[model samples]
Target: MSLDTTTLLAIVAMALVTYVTRIAGLFVADRLVLTGRAKAAFDAIPPAVLVAVIAPTALTTGWVEAIAAAITAVAAFRLPLLGTVAVGVISVVLLRNVL
Candidate 1:
């Protein structure tokens, strides 16, 4: 019914954590050396991270949507970055509205 100090503090702390975590990478990147192996790892990281993140979401939704998203992702992978994003957004919006 009333705003409490503990809840307010917790919310502020969470916001700070989110902001720091997101921006921390920029600071960390400036500090790090991108050597041969590090460069390779960094290059490979995007696809690896994408699969890691997408696989679970796609699988959980169901075979149909999952397969659709995968197909869209693959197609997007081949297209220009903006095109890929457009394809993905269009697919999701159509699916959500139609189904």
Candidate 2:
């Protein structure tokens, strides 16, 4: 698929906005003294962001996607991150086409 000018410009705009906000936040936060609770919350950022990005799409797609996501979640505890993702993607694709 070819990206048109509008799509390219939109992507650039999004990138610029993301960088500006991230940099500004870092600049501001660097000067602050973080407390214990705040530090704990900061440490939770990765998983919280992952869930925020993944949960809605996984839940809304269909039962196949939901089951795949559930399996991925369980697999995540026992398998490597890459393996869990592979299981989820394969299951979702197979289930979607089969049923």
Candidate 3:
């Protein structure tokens, strides 16, 4: 199979842009100090983004996935990150098999 030139160029460009953006973020992050509401907001971002991504898939897929997602959300609050992920995976697998 032959590699297309345009595809290769696009891939290279994307890699370069990602690398530059990460490096820029690192430099900016060194000088950045978040406080009070800003710190709280910043801390919330990861979970918010996680929900934003997973919510659609969980809601759209099926009842079993929806239930599993709900269970996972509850576990997320009670458990640590790894435990939460474990619950999500295990619940989904068990639900898919049982229902």
Candidate 4:
């Protein structure tokens, strides 16, 4: 099937935007002088991002999710990150079904 001119233009526009965003991210990262606190914060970004994303969802979902999050927080201190996530997910599933 042939794509219309408008569709083709839209696809090209999206491709350019995607490429520009990726290039801009690299350019900005190269310019940043991450030292001291900045370096520490940058290193913490992945976990911080996860908490920022997960916290809101956990809070808004039902009691099961909040309970799972609480349990996960405790497990996180003892387990690895992936282990914490797995425990949290399995707990959620069990809580959802059992409660």
Candidate 5:
């Protein structure tokens, strides 16, 4: 019911820690390098990581949704990047509304 000093300090400390960690990325970024194969691997990493995380969630939710999502993902992979994203969003929105 009351805001104690310890609780306020803990919240402040947590915020400061989060801010420091995020800003640390910029400090070290200039020292980091992605060359040749490393750059290619880095490019693929995000999509692969995203699919690994999203695929399981979609599967657990529903097979039909997963199939629909797969169709959208394939379109995203083959088409122009912005066009793919637009088609994917429209497909999912339509699927949700109509199906």
Candidate 6:
């Protein structure tokens, strides 16, 4: 199969843009500081993004997934990121098998 010129150019452009943005973020992040409410809000971003990603899948799937998501949410507050993810995976697998 032959590579199309337009497709090759598009792929190269996308890769360049992605690399540039990531490098820029690293530079900007090093110089940035957060304090007070801003720090709190910044700290909350990860869990909020996690929930945002998980919520739609949980809501759309079924009661089993929704229950598992609830369990995961509880774990998120008490556990580290890896532990919370472990809980989510384990709960979903067990729930799917049992219910």
Worst 10 residues of 5 by lDDT: 60-69
> What range of 10 consecutive residues in model 6 has the weakest lDDT sum?
45-54
For 1-99, candidate 5 gives per-residue lDDT tens digits of: 899999999999999999999899788766879899978987998889988998888778876567677877889768987987787677777787877
Q: For candidate 1, report its TM-score.
A: 0.59
Write one digit per residue (lDDT tens) for candidate 6, span 1-99.
Answer: 999999999999999999999999899988889899988998999878977997998999999999998999899889998999999999999999999
Q: Which rank order by lDDT, best down to worst?
A: 3, 4, 6, 2, 1, 5
Model 2 residue 95 lDDT score: 87
The collision pairs in model 4 are: none
Give candidate 1 regions above 4 Å deviation.
69-99
Over 26-81, each residue of candidate 3 has an lDDT whose tens digit, in order, gives 99978889999988998999989988998999999999999999999999889999
Residue range with the least summed lDDT across 10 consecutive positions in model 4: 41-50
What TM-score does each of the candidates earn? 0.59, 0.62, 0.78, 0.69, 0.70, 0.76
Which stretches in model 3 have alpha-carbon errors above 4 Å?
1-15
Candidate 2: regions farther than 4 A off:
1-20, 28-37
Worst 10 residues of 3 by lDDT: 25-34
Each prediction's Cα lDDT score? Answer: 0.82, 0.90, 0.95, 0.95, 0.82, 0.93
Instruction: Name the regions of candidate 5 deviating beyond 4 angstroms.
Output: 93-99
Residue pairs that clash (backbone atoms under 3 angstroms), model 2 = none
lDDT of 1 by residue, 1-99 (tens): 899999999999999999999899889988998989989999999979987998798789876567568768788758987887677777777776677
- Residues 67-97, model 4: lDDT tens digits: 9999999999999989998999999999999
Per-residue lDDT of 1 in model 1? 86
> Model 4: what TM-score?
0.69
Estimate the overall C-alpha local distance difference test score of candidate 5. Answer: 0.82
Answer with 1 or 3, whichever has the higher lDDT: 3
**Deviation (Å) of 12 in candidate 6:** 0.7
